[model samples]
Target: MDSLHHDLTVVEQIEVSPPHATIGCKSLPLTFSDIAWFAFPDPVHTLFFYDHPITQTIFIETIVPTLKQSLSITLQHFFPFVGKLAIFPTSTRIPEIRYVEGDSVAVTFAESDLDFNYITGNHPRECHKFYHLIPLLGSTTKVSDYITIPVFAVQVTLFPNHGIFIGMTNHHNLCDASTRFCFLKAWTSIAQSGGSDEPFLANGTLPIYDRLLKYPKIDESFVKNANVETFDEEYKLPRLSGPTNEVRATFILTRTKINGLKKLVSTQLPTLAYVSSFTVACAYIWSCATKVEKDELAAFIFVIDGRSRLDPPIPAAYLGNCVMPCFTLARTTILKSKEGFVTAAKLIGQNLHKMLSDKDGIVKDIGSFEE
Candidate 1:
């Protein structure tokens, strides 16, 4: 662990904001879907490795400036990324992301001495080895009636002469995976076009900021579940630390393998309502994980994008979270049996079918968070 600390060096730390005075004070309130995640302390971390080799001089002179300039321009369109989350101490006052003029996102430039190829491989590696690449959000600070928390940060690490790694850390309450992907698409397009947002403006979709989904009871329930009154000046997000036994690896399931699992599920349960690649993949993984466990009940929880499932249906580009949870539970003994995979598939498929086919609409049970 001590050696891991010495393997990476911080080159520079800077803050990038939109062009001077382009964005004034702006705030976006959190909906029920977003408020459901208010109590979650883990921020989302992502790393992108590009196998482009270049010298340190070229990296600093060319790559660094290009990214910084493009990100600054991109922030003009996605102002919420540079904003801070404002959390009030009482549930009566909901939380929101507020951005004032001159607010910027923290960006770090770093260089690592570790093997780029080995770290990028599919094999399992110590999770701590990659922690240095992820940047931490700014500390939470109290301002009069509310606390402000930084929602997003970026870190770009150069594995000099091997590859370039881009790491991003974002608070979940700010946005979901789809919104983040859209932001990246816009950023990369602007960067490739030499810091000009003309190309992005021509083809990209701008985020919809209107608070579209409205369910007052559901929102109140989620706020109560989050226990907003407990938040104070001392609140801080959980940080990832090193020197642990955890290892991370990626597993790929080929199209043929996925089809085989689908076929197996279809053959056993001909009347099953849903048996797509996703359900089968989840069932297979869940079965494998619980096979060694003792005979006790276990639960599997996954989220479904509610954009299309809502009554009026939300725009694909609507910002913030619009997802609902789907849960499946079964005994470990059943999962470890010979028909474990099939049983798991049945459970997941039925649960999803029931949730999506609810007569009262998909958002009806959103108040379940209070349970």
Candidate 2:
């Protein structure tokens, strides 16, 4: 028999209520920054065990207020624009399973455990996952300028066996991996400390949004008074399948690996930095495929993140998907050459820098076309 079994006895008297509001923020004329934090579609949940059988009534009473207070403080600073984006705050809800007399305890355990399994499913393109918390999938909400993503709560439950589970899910597109972790850590600390009168949230002084908003004519006019070109056909990527599937070949290079690659390159060029490693790798990949891809005249493309090199820091993190891709061109024969990788990487990096540095016609070109 479980030692905590008797302690799990049900109490009929005490009562608790759910938190009235959750932590979130609001903003407008939204951009990728607003959507990025919202895209982590996984649920975020946590579990705890109380020393005594926590009656449903008492459990809700003690937990709800704490959740509300903590979240309220965390959101005001971390995600100042979340509420403005979403009609409502994603929340804290305690979901419980009822059991009948003499039902096997093991059966109860299985059902409650489903929550944990749900949190680990998909890692979104944005690269954030709450493996520990289940995401509320396929839900949507509307806020301000954009549609609201289906908001989810980290569900908490106390079992008759004196164990508890909390689950969470969030989409990665909405927040960067780092920002997601920061929010989680802050939320967890608050939960553990009960409720504090003063929440240590970050003070947001960045006014990139305010400045952009000031130029309303330039802002709204750019998107509206523009000439829109219509492509004759929809563009789509070629799908790769079958025996030769796309395999992720991730290599974590140590300082040694980097140094060795540089040494090899320097034997000819006299000086080469490890930053060119990706270019080298790309060359190797292209050489292997040139015969096949070139025969078909297919285009090969690589993506770059153009940020910070702008005249002013473009609020890349806060601005969400504030990114553009630059391309490097080559013939099949060029890619097959031994020096292709270095040459390509150098050109890629240089092009990236040039794109960010060139401000004369960047936005203006597009606006003029649209107008």
- Poorest 10 consecutive residues of model 1 by lDDT? 361-370
Q: In candidate 1, what are the lDDT values of residues 243-317, reduced to their tens digit?
A: 699998989999999999999999999999999999999999999999778889999998888887776778989
Cα lDDT computed for each candidate against the true fold:
0.90, 0.38
lDDT of 2 by residue, 27-69 (tens): 4343323233232323333333333445545555765456555
On TM-score, the leading prediction is: 1
TM-score of each: 0.94, 0.46
Worst-scoring 10-residue span by lDDT in model 2: 102-111
Candidate 1: clashing pairs of residues: none
- Alpha-carbon error at 156 in model 2, in Å? 12
